[model samples]
Target: MDTHTPASHEVKLSLQTDLTPAQAEILDNGAQQFLEKLVQRFASRVPQLLAARETRQAAIDAGTLPDFLPETAEIRNSEWKIQNIPTDLQDRRVEITGPVDRKMVINALNADVKVFMADFEDSFAPAWNEVLDGQRNLRDAVNGTIDYTNPENGKHYQLNDDPAVLICRVRGLHLPEKHLLWQGEAIPGCLFDFALYFYHNYQQLLAKGSGPYFYLPKLQAHQEAAWWSEVFSFTEDEFGLPRGTIKATVLIETLPAVFEMDEILYSLKEHIVGLNCGRWDYIFSYIKTLRNHPDRILPDRQVVTMEKPFLNAYSRLLVKTCHRRGAFAMGGMAAFIPSKDPERNEWVLNKIQTDKLLEANNGHDGTWVAHPGLASTAMAVFDGVLGERSNQLDISRSEDAPITAAELLAPCDGERTEDGMRHNIRVAVQYIEAWISGNGCVPIYGLMEDAATAEISRASIWQWIKHGKTLSNGQMVTKALFEQMLKEEMDVVKQEVGEARFAAGRYDEAAVLMSRLTTSDELVNFLTVPGYEYLS
Candidate 1:
C-alpha cells in the first residue's frame, strides 16, 4: 500500500488551539490522502443531498403526507435482510453512551455493558481540543491503556480488562469539523471522525476480536445511508481490508428515516448490522420537519413520553422493521441518571425499569443509557427477556404492521402546563450553558440531558409560540411570554449555580443563545451548529 502525506498547503489546519508536535503527527497520519479521496468523491454530493431535505419539507408544507416510499416499494416487499451480525454486535442487550472525554471513555467502557457508544455527536461539545483529545483517548482505549487520574480528586480510573465493545458515533452530516479545512471548506465532521478512527484503529480493533463498528447518527434518508456505505467500502479498499469489514448501526432518528427503514438497510446491507431508535432526536426532527404546520405542534417535552401514541408507533415500527430485516432493534436512551437521594433514585429507577421493560417486551434486542449506574438496571430488564438469545431478529414484523405515516403525523393532544413551560426554559438555558462551556451531556432534574433534549426544549418553545399555544393557565404563548420566562429561568440558573460559577459559567451567553433560537422565525436543524461556534 502506497500512501503519501501532502504538504500543509494542500489542506489548512484551522484549529484554534495549539497542537503539540506529537498530536499534530497523530492527526496528520493518512489524513491528507483520506480527506482528498473523501472530498473528491463526496463533497459536492452533500449540498445536493441537503437540498433533498428542503424538497421533502416543501412537500410536507404543501400538504403531501410522508409515507413509505413507493419507488422503493419492492425493496420493502422483498425478502432480503442484512447479513453477518458479528459476534460482538449480536448480543447488544445494554449499550451505554457518553462523550469521548477521558473519564467517560474509561467509565463507559469499563461499565460491563454489551456496547459503549463513544459519541462525537449529541453528547459531546466539539471543541478542537475535545475532538482531538477524544480521538487520542479512544486510540489509547483500543490499545488497552486508557486511564486517567483526576487531578482535583486524586482518583485513578482505568478500563476493565474486559471492556464493552466500542462503537464510535460520528457527528451528523450537517456538522463540519471546522478546525480542519480541506480546499478552503470545513471538512465534514463525519469523515474526519470516521477516517481518523478507521485509519488509525481498524486493524488494531480487528486484532482485538472487535472490528470497526459505528453508530450512524441523524441520517435522514436512504441516500445518506448509501453515501456512508460507499465511504465504508472506499476506506476498506483503501486499507486493503475486506469489503464487509466495517459494520454500522443506523440511528433512525429523523422522521423521514423511519419511513425509509428497509431501503436504508438495503442501501448498506453488507455493512449494516442494526437500526437504533434515537428517540430524542426523532422528536426534534418531528418538530423541525413539521415546523411549517401550525396544527402539528407537539405538547411540552416532558409530557411526550415514549409510550405516547406517535413514539409508541415509531418504536413498534422500528422493532418490527429491524427484526424482519434481520437486524437488531436497539432502543433509545434511558436518560435518567441515578439520583443521590434514595427516594429520588428509586423513583428514577422505577421509571427506567418501566421504559426498558416496554422495549424488551416489544422484542428490542437492546437499549441505551447515559450513565453507567443505570447499566445494570437496563441489563437486568433485557436479560429477563433475552436470557441467552443473541437477538430477536427471527421474529418477522411484516410490512402491514400497525403504523402509518398519517398516524405518525397525527397531533399529540395534551395540556401545556405552566410548569412544563418553565421546565423547558430552565433546561434549555442550563443545557446550552453547559454545552457552550464544553459539556454536552448534563444531568438536570435527575435526567441526563444531551443536545437532543435541548433541541426539543427550544424547538417546542418555538412551535408553541408559532402556533399561539395557550398554557394550562390560559396565558397565550408569545415571544414576550417566552422572553419573560427565559429571564426568570436565567435568574433561577444564576441562583442554582451560585454567583461566582454562574458569572464564569457563560450563562449570559447561553441565555442570549437560547432566547435567540426560540425567537427566530426559521427552524434550526441543530443547536450544535451555533453552539460549536461559541466553544473555545
Candidate 2:
C-alpha cells in the first residue's frame, strides 16, 4: 500500500483507491489542493474564534450555551493515605464508600488502560442541582479528595496530582431542547453570538493559569480542531502556563470527523492526545450523511456490531493514521458494560473483550472504559495488547530527552501539597456538584450505562472530598501519590456503585435521589443507520 519511501525526516504516505475518471481528472488539475487552500483561508476566522473561547471558558456552565464555545485541570501535596487506591499493576480493585489505598487504584490503571472518567455527563439522568453537584464531585475527584466520596456529607475536596490523568467527557454541544423550544427563545446556539461566546469560554476559565485538559466531543472538522488549538494557545499565553499543557482527547463522533481525520489530526497534533471513534454518534452521523444516497442503507438502533466491514475499515484507517503520526490510536466506546442480568452482563463482557481484541490487534493502544465496574476488565485487555508488564514508551524524537527511558521506568515521587491538593479537589467537586444540579454525570457516560445509574451517588463523596478530606479511621494518606492514584478512582467507583445499587434494589434511593441521572428521552435517543445496525 505504501510504495512511496519515507523522506529522511518525514513519514511516507499513500492511499490506495479506485477513482472514477472524473475524480482522476480533478486530481490532475490539482483542484483538491486549490479547494483545500480555499477552505483553510475561509476557516481561519472560525479557528481563531474557537481559540478565544478556549482562552476564556469559565463563562460557560452559566446555563447559557454560548453561540460559540471555549474549550476545554490538577493538584498535589498533602497527607492523604496511599493505601486507598491502586499503586501497582496488581492493584486492580477499587473500594466504594469505604477507604482503600491510592496505590491499588494506580495499580489498576497502569496494569490496564481503563481510564476512570468521573462523569457529570451521559452516565446519569440529570437534574439541575445534580449537575452542579456532579461538577463539584468531578473537581474533587481530580484533587483526590477521597472523602468527596459522599457529597451528602458536605465534605471539602483536597487532592494531589494533575487531574488530567482522570479523563472526563462532558455534555454534548447540541440544541438546548429537543422536542420543543420556548415561543421566543427557540433553544440555544442557534442565534447566539457563537464566535464571541465561544471566544470568551476558554479565555475566562483556562486563564486561571494552571492545569488545562479536556475530552472534546461532537467535533466535525479540521476547522474545528484549528479553532480549539488557537484557543488553547491563547489561554496558555494569557495564563502564563506552558503552551500545549492543555491537551485534548478529541472525539471523532460524527461522520465528518471520521472523513476529515487527516485534517483534524494535522491541525491539532501538538495538543491532541488522540482521536476517539464515537459509536452512537458515528451510527447517527452515517444515517444523516447518507440519507440522500439511494444505495446506502442503515439498520435499527439495537443491532450495531463493532465487527462489521465498514467499522473494520474505519478502525483500520484510524489506527494507521494515528500510528503513522506517532500519536495514540484510541478504540471505540464499549457501551453495554455488565448489566443487571448476569447473563446479559457476561454477554456484554465477552463482547467488550472481542471488541478490545479487535482494536488492539488492529493497532489501537487505548480503549474507553464506560463504567467503573468495567475498569479492571478493560485494563486486563490492554495488558494483553501491550504484551509486557512495562509501560509502552514511544521512542523519543531526539536524543536530548530530559529523562531517560530508565528514569521513566524508575520509581519517582510526585505528591500533592495541601493547597495544591485543595485546589484540584475544589475543581473536581465543583464539577460534579454542578452536574448533579445542572447537567449530571450520566450525560457524559450515556453510551455505557443507563441514565439514573448510581454513579450519581459518588457525586456526594466527591463533594465531601471538596472539603479537607480527612481519613482518620486508620491510614496516613499522602495528598501527593493519592493525588495521582485514588483521585480518578472515584469516578469509576461511583459509576460502578451506581450500577450495583440499581441491581441491589435500591433504585429509589440510588437512582431517584440522584435524579440528575436522567436526560430527556430524545437527547439520549439516536436514529440508527440502515445496513449498519450490526456495527454499534
Candidate 3:
C-alpha cells in the first residue's frame, strides 16, 4: 500500500489507497485534521490498553482467575448515576441492527423499532469501498435523504416519516484501518469510524434534538471505558458542544468486562446510558479467555444457550449492576430470521418471543433483533412487561444473592453430538466465505449469522479438540477426526449450494482457513484479525 499525503492539511495524513471524489469529500481538509488530532492525542494509548489485556489473559492462563478489582471497590460501593439519557434513547424497547448498506439503512430505520444500530463491526467487512460507502450511507440517512433502488427486482426503498433513532457501532480496538495511517502506522479502526461519523453528523443530529449516540463494543476493562470517555470529552470540547452531549451504551461482551460492570459504568457515567449483553461474543470470549482450562471445555455451540448457569448469572448480575447505577440493562440479540414456510416462520416467531420474554421478565429495558420481521414479536414481549414504562430500571434485583466468580466461570453441562460438530463446520465455512467476499452479515440455515456467532463456531471446535473431548456417540474429537468431518461437511456444502455457485464462491479457501483455525497449535484471539488479511 502506497501512501498519499493531502497537501492541504498541516497535520500529515497518509492514505494507502486512492480515494474517489466522493470519498475525498468525506475525508476533506477539516475531517483530516480532526482525525489526525485524534490519532496524535489518543491512538498511542490503544495498544497499551491492549497489552494490559494480554497481561491479564496471561495471569488467567497461569491459573489465576478474573475477579472484581480491589482498587475499584470504592467506585463500585459509591453511589453514582450516569447523566440523564436523551429522550430519544429512553424508550428503546426494541432495537434492530444491521450493516450500513444503503438498503439495510433505509429498511432498518423505517422498521417499527425504537433504535437501529448501524454496525461497522461484526456485521461489516472493512474493505476500503465498503467502509467509505458506509459512511456516505449513514450521512444520507442522518440527512433524511437516503434511498436505494434494487436492480434485481426494480424495487425502490426509502425511509418513512418516522424512523427509528440511529446509533452507530464502530469496530473494536483490536482491529486496524489498514488503508489509513498516522505517523506511518495504521490508526485504530474505532477512531477512524468514530471520527468520520461524528464530524459529519453531530451538528445535524443536535439540530434535530438528538445527540451523537454510539454503541461501544468489546471492552475488557473499565480503563478502556475511561479511554472512550476521554475521546467523547475531547470531541465535545473541540466542537463546542456541552459536556455530556455524547451518549454511549457499552457492550458487556467479554468475560472480564462482566466483572467490572459497575466500574465501567462509573468511568463513563457522564456520557453513558446503559450496558448490553453481547451474548454471542461473550460465549466466544469465555472459550478464548479460558483456552487452557481443561475442565472448562464447552460442549456443542447449539447446546450452550443463555439459560446455562454461567450465562444466567451473567445476565442477572448485569441487570442488578446497571439498574442499581440508574442505567438501562439491555438484553442480547435474537438472531433468527423469518422463514419462507408458514409453519417454520411461526416456529421462528415462537422462539423469538420466548427469548425476548425471558429478557423482559428478567427486567431488561430492551433487546436486540437482527431482522425487521422480528421487531414486533420482541416489542410485544417488552410491551407486556413494561406497559407504559419506557424501561424497567426500577426493578433492581437487590434481594438476589450476589453472583460469585465461580458461578460466572461455571462449566456448562451438555452432551456433544456429531451432528452439532458438523453444524459448526458448515456455519463457520459459509460465514468465512461470505466475510472474505466483502459481506459480513449473512443468512444461513434460517438464521442471521455474523462474525461473533462464527467465532463461537470455530472456537468451540478448537477447544473441544484441545481437550480431547468425546462426543455423545463416544467418538473422540481430534485433529484427524475433525479433518475428516471437514471434508465431509464441505461435500455437503457443495451439494447444497450447487457446483456452479460453489465453484464461483470462496468455499475452498474458506474450508482451508477453517481447517487451519480449528487445528492450529495455539488458539487465535479473533478469526477476524487473521481473516482480515484476505479482505481487499
What is the TM-score of each predicted model, taking all chains together? 0.96, 0.49, 0.98
lDDT of 2 by residue, 1-536 (tens): 11211123321112124445633442322322322232233333543544543443333223222221112101011111111111221211111110012322333223334244433334432332233333444443443453423357764433434322444444433323111122322222211112211222333333343233456666765666776677556545533555665666677766546656656666776677666666656655444333333233332233345665555656666665554455556677665545778887787788778877777666666676655566566667777767653322242222332222222112212232333333333333333432333322232222333222222222222322333233324223333434443345444445545766435432233222222212111111221111012111
Which candidate leads the pack in lDDT? Answer: 3
lDDT per residue as tens, model 1, 199-251: 77887888878999998998889999999999999877777778889999999
Q: Residue 456's C-alpha lDDT in candidate 1?
A: 96
- How many clashes in each structure? 0, 167, 0
Q: Measured by TM-score, how close is model 3 to the native structure? A: 0.98
Clashes of 3: 0
- Those runs of model 2 whose alpha carbons end farther than 4 Å from true positions after fitting are 1-114, 120-128, 146-164, 172-210, 339-343, 389-536
Q: Indicate whether candidate 2 or candidate 3 has the larger TM-score.
A: 3
Consecutive 10-residue window with the lowest summed lDDT within model 3: 1-10
Error of 2 at 368 (Å): 1.4
> Relative to the true structure, how large is the alpha-carbon lDDT of every model?
0.87, 0.41, 0.92
Encode model 3's per-residue lDDT on 1-536: one tens digit a residue. 11223246585868888889999989877788889989999999999999999999999999988899999999988888888889899899899999999999999999979999999999988888999999999999999999999999999999899989999999999999988888889899999999999988888888898879999999999999999999999998777778999999999999999999999999999999999999999999999999989888888888888889999999999999999998999999999999889999999999998889888988899999999999999988999999989899989999999999999999999988999999999999999999999999999999899999999999999999999989999999999999999999999999999999999999999998999899999898888888899888
Order of quality (TM-score)? 3, 1, 2
- Give me the displacement of residue 16 in model 1, in angstroms: 7.2
Q: Whose lDDT is higher: candidate 1's or candidate 2's?
A: 1
